[model samples]
Target: MFRTHSFVLLALMALLVLTQCTSAPDRSTKDPAEAVDVADQELSLTEEKSAGDWLQEADAAANEVEQHSALIRAANAFQNEHQWQQAAAILSQLAPKKITHHSQKYYRLAKARWAAEQKVWAKVIEELEDVATQFNQREFRVLSLQLLSQAAYQQQDYWQSLVWQVDAQRFAEQRNTDTVWSIARRIKQSELPQQRPNDLALAGWWRLVDYHHQAMTHPDSLTSFLNQWQQSFPNHDAATLVDIWLEPPLKPSESELEAEQAPPEPTLAVLLPLSGRYKQQGQAVRDGVIARTGEMKNLRVVFIDSEASDIESQQKQISELSPVGIIGPLLKDKVAAWSAQPITGIPQVYLNQIDDEAAQNSLTNVFFALSPESEAQQAAQKINQQFPSSKSALVITADGSSGRRMVDAFTSSWENEQAEQPTISYFSEREDMKTTVERSLGLTDSQQRIRAVKIAAGKIIVDEQERSRRDISAIYLPGNLQQTRLLKPFIDVSVSPFAEPIPVYASSATHELRNRLGDSDLNGIIFSDVPWLIESSGKNILLSQWLELRNGWGLSLARLTAMGYDSVSLIQRLEMMNRMPGLVWSGLSGELHIDNSVVQRKLIWATFSKGEITLAKEADNAGSRYR
Candidate 1:
């Protein structure tokens, strides 16, 4: 097993440089073939001789003659012994022209592989490009292209990566029996398409992939884009290929969709603090609920002022009204007070989330809120889902209870998904945010930077040397709009601009307010929120109309309005959801699914680019830098 693994390593580390070391003076005067034959015999007797013994014999044979075959044998033995540098050294010693074509190809590939291991990306690309352009064998060419694709991707030059994959696909298709098509398909499907100049094939292909990616989140736009692409690129092969995705989504049959189930309770009651300090919030909730239920024939909703000073008095008045199901009491204290009691015979949905340990555990009724924790969890989930390569996260959060909970929720959710535990840092003041971020990201390693600089005897030199840790693949900041805006630039400047950009993820708190100038600074930060807030598709007919009528609304209040809108529909389906655990209801808030009376909302995502907030699609460009 060790030998097999070693052989694979040797195959990959095949070397390429033009330089060669002169033969040793005491080298044997035997024919090159004779030396190789002896080495081959020693390799064959691996069971008799230890790997160390075989390596010594191969080394002697390689040094004795300036033979390509002998040198390759020595390199193979070195690789098998896990002496990667030694194996690379042997391959480097042999001139490409002196070696057989097969050995030469492996030699060059090995050089590229070794360079990649050293993070010498330029050398890796140079060698791989040589093999890709000069190699005659299709398999070798494909291998070179594959490595080049990876190399380009690592450099974040996704355009070059896609181009290489396209070339690989063409070569693979020529062979017909090769499975490289799957490789191309995986890359195309997973990567976001970038517009390529002077390459019609890629440009056309980009449209198809872009359409497919957008369609995942916006199915309504798919058919229109499909038609546009087909019309624009009439005879392009890429256009023909899009036919596979052209299949429209399957709609539920009229009977299945309209099938009669249990009718919702005749009377739905809304519990709101209509005449107290929380009047504005309660009114918004009431307005949203009323808009949705206004046209329903068999349904009547009673709006009850739930701000009665005595908790018992409020409950008594609610019970007297005799609502089949109650929605809200949009205050945390009220929800906590009610959660202490047993179920109130009537089904209830509270619009405020309670974080109190006992209150959370005691709830029998459905608890729904625009929870910061839930939003944090969803943000972590979406980041993990979108960028699987990003395992480690560096979190920068504020030093308050709410901020701490948001970070904890994010970390817990990420870790629960079996992702690595994130590194966390905190700041108490806005003034300390930059310093906190720099320290957490290891960007403030000034001592190390000073040591890295080469000082002159008398004069100062190399003043601007900096280094930052690269292990962090993503950054999670659960701050409000201002904090998010300030921290993003600090993060960007703290790390070396040459390093690969780590993706920044935040909860809805970051993007909650619609401030163009404020959001402009938050460009490239990916965050998740309720679909109703980000998407302008009018999926929620009544809610969209409400927003249109009210030109501008507070972000906090708007969320409550959505909570109210979903509450009405969710109440109607709560009984059915309990019966069918697998059933999910798509509401304005998100894709709503319930587990243990706690409604989990899988929110939609969006990112800020060029001062505009756009719905994030499942494409590579979703996280790409603004051009």
Candidate 2:
């Protein structure tokens, strides 16, 4: 009987152990993703050290032989990092140095100095006057004279800048067959004098060479100019100009190098495929460039239909007229065609940057009006500033090259802004993708911040059988209307799985999101974009002109008109600050901010609710938005 009792007790103990084992596995042992809910609910977004502040650090990184290069690089670094003071400090160091470099170097230094806003005219004039001396490098001297005149004009000494410009022309003409002749030609709106220029040889010595590079369309302009200049005056080195050319634009101030105006009757070739299927965008860009030409002097834009069957044919035709500059050929393919044809010794500012194949052996006097790649990079920087805490930025894109380009640009910007090496998760699709996301946030455990919060919000419920993990803070989803809409349900629904909510961000949250997903679908969702339209405020003397445009031109046309006015009027402000290069470029377009071609006209944070986007608040932040 005792033996039987012992056996029964041991069996009872074994049964009890089995019962406990069979119970729903405790969160501690169920799966790595099981406890993810608890983590996601509690994790808060962490702030990254401002990438904009890297300028100061980079400036401190400058060395001796590479002093100028170091300064330029540091400035570029600061601009890329958005470090305003660091850029200024590096630029200011050169301010006190006597102007000894060639006009090219001076031009470059002047631009950097101007960008840094340290006495632009003072520095420009200081170097220019030295070149003005007959003893200076002949071409550089002439260039300096013209640049000096510009500084003088900037100070409302129009007569002075003009006089100096004439002097520069005379000097460049003397050095005819040199690059300064082009400067004088471009300066004169391409209205070359019947009297061969006498001052072309005395173009920008050093500093001047570096300054106008920002406006150069053809990458070879500087290269070609330097090659000839060095050949002519090899004993007098002008190698420093390269440093100025590579210097980054000001981070705080927007110093887009634009000539005052192009001359009228100046055969401006409209190099766009106006007759092709892609003619609409080409036309749009052409219109913007053309309408503004009137604002410039002697600037008659000749529309050269680049709608030929082949780019080679179009190039042959375009060369005959030898327009002052060519704009458009909206498609890169068209540009590729034009690239095959050699330039007609005329300046060309392409609306887009040339590809490596074309740009490699392309003609002189060519440049990209605005490189989309550059703009994309700028837009990316803006994203980081606007949304610093964003973790996984989802890019819902259409399957195309343009979409890929946008993604690439966003990625570049994100990488530049990401100081912590934080990763921005990307998604490419057009359907329900909850499973993929759940895996990222943590399908099984809930301890990871992104996973835990995602799970807690019920956005991605880790079933008893899933696995997920994510090292992120937020989500970025950028795509077309359809792609964005498809992502809406997944984002909103995934969050629903948790008790609280996780922020889902996008580049553009427009009418498309609400129309498809419904208002409540993207309730707390956030997005940022440069709206096509917005209200404006400022002392606009041209407001009357704008009003007139409103009457004659559509809002789009008015905006275009505004662009011209702003471009012209901005010189006034730039002239006044002559030395205040470090200040931010704030103007009429709300903030008048631009990373590159992608200007941040306005960014309004909104939540979709009931087919309407409600602007949450006005922002005075310095950085761009999150992805």
Candidate 3:
């Protein structure tokens, strides 16, 4: 009986051990199928939950772990859908301490992305500055670094931004070498430290930027400079970039060197409507081109009548000539048509600007226009500079397409600079101008108040009216010469004697040298115009030629002549200007520069004083006036 009882006890002990093993098996030795089942269950839980379902789950979660997980999922889902506000709301509910250890990094990244969307750079830096280094995924790591770089750039910490961009390029699938180079360029040479940084990558990048700056003026030394740089930074990440900068040295024979020194003269094709409605304007441009190339033996000029019946025949002729560059299609429609069918190798300079989105992206096509809009933008900048303390402005433009464009440009530029929108008024006729000016200055309201007081007294009273609104600090007038002549007087008279004199600014359309005697009405108004029209100190080499042209073909046509001259001057320098930002070419049309394939002109500022135009005192002080 005792032996049987002992055997029964051993059997019971074995059964107990088998039950325990089945209930909780060792995880390391668990069956692969069972482990996969558990993982599938967790994934199914996540996949089943929608953003709304996740939010609901978060609210109903019984523990901190479940709540945090649910909230993170909800925020991420909303973020993926670009529902930023909803994502922000979801993230705001998450407690930092309650977030799961694995989800903490992702939560911070989501929050930072939301901040970036809101343009809150400080918040982005605050959230990502510490957590960015923890990301193990290449994509997440790269994104974090890029966000940090962009945030730093927005905050004007360019050095830090450069550091972040370089780090990103190291880890990213595709290197952002151009972006790194561009950011490095923004750091001024003067701002660079006297002592090189200890970071080899950063120091190498700085040296590269310095090399590029030196190469802009002295390209011949680039190969030698690049070789020296590579030797200095042999193991640096930018060592590979040296290959891009290095050009093969030309070992030419004496004859080859001579041939290179004096290469074949380039032929330039000029297309203009020489015999149609724009005959006079086209002739002026042709004459201007001839005048500019009269002394040049290295260039050949050819003219094509753009308005001729056989346009395709003209194109064939253009191809046959094999001109190095083509400049023309002055009419907007012609420019658009020419831009549609671009010549693959030859560069084109359009005389008029087009709004076609595709044309703006063409590498070989340049849009150069004597744009009144450009003048309006400069006028806005000039006003802001001259009147830094002025908070508000009034834009008085004529009621036309040109005037509307001027108003739009000025308003856009003014708001960008001041962070405040200016008031705008439009006029159609002479009476409209008077009424618009009076109403804009609050003179009409003042007169009404005076009449109201007289009516209240029920008798005629000689009571002076209150001053015009004092809020307006400046006036922008964008109009033609006739409109300006009619509008300036009304503005001068409408202001109450008690008010401070509001300075008036005008666009180039308002200025004409021949009409200077009539500009007595335009006195005290500062306007932007080309150097050819405003400069008479014999500084502009083309000023004499411009005067001669103006005497023969009116001021209106002479301006086109100046455009033609500038177009020719820019042809050879376009490539250089495109590659080098902030490079200025002193041209007769204006201070010419290129940005994104568009040649922009920075006009000189001049003010009418006693019916004569003189460079604005501010412009003269800044040395922008013709010397």
lDDT of each: 0.65, 0.43, 0.72
Q: Cα deviation of 299 in candidate 3 (Å)? A: 3.1
Residue 294 shift from truth in candidate 1, angstroms: 2.2
Residues 1-627, model 2: lDDT tens digits: 236675455334333322332242331232222222221122111213232232232233222222233234444443344444544544455432322232125325335344434545555555545435543446445544655666665554433443465556555645322333223222221121233223432333322333232223333354455456555554332344334434564543233224324333556676666676755555555545544566566655666666665666667777766575555555666666555564655544444445454354322323333333444454455445545663444444455676677667767667423334433334545433555454445542443554556667785655442323233444555554556556666655444343345555555423341242235655666655323222221233354444454443333333333333333223222211211111123333223322222223334345555655555454356421110
Global fold similarity of model 1 (TM-score): 0.53
Model 2 misplaced regions, further than 4 Å: 1-264, 294-298, 309-322, 357-380, 386-409, 416-431, 443-471, 496-503, 508-627
Model 3 lDDT per residue over 1-627, tens place? 226665455334333332332234331332222222211114221245566666666555544555566667777766766666667766765567655556777788889999999988878888888888888777778888999999888865676788788888878887766788667755544445556678787889878766655554444465677788988988876666577546454577988677675555678999999997988888878877887888566788989999984557767888877788898978888888788886667878899998886678755678998877888888777766666654778898878887788888887778334435788998877778888989998988988898788888886666776568787778988877787778888888888786778898887777765664336767898877777777873355565656665575566676788888888777766654554344566787888767678998988877788967788787333421111
lDDT of residue 340 for candidate 1: 77
Best-matching candidate per TM-score: 3
Name the weakest run of 10 consecutive residues (lDDT summed) in model 2: 38-47
Top lDDT model: 3
Please give the lDDT score at residue 200 for candidate 3: 80
Reference-based lDDT, residue 332, model 2: 66
Off by over 4 Å in 3: 1-81, 90-112, 120-145, 151-164, 171-174, 178-264, 287-297, 307-309, 380-391, 412-420, 453-463, 515-520, 535-541, 579-586, 610-614, 617-627
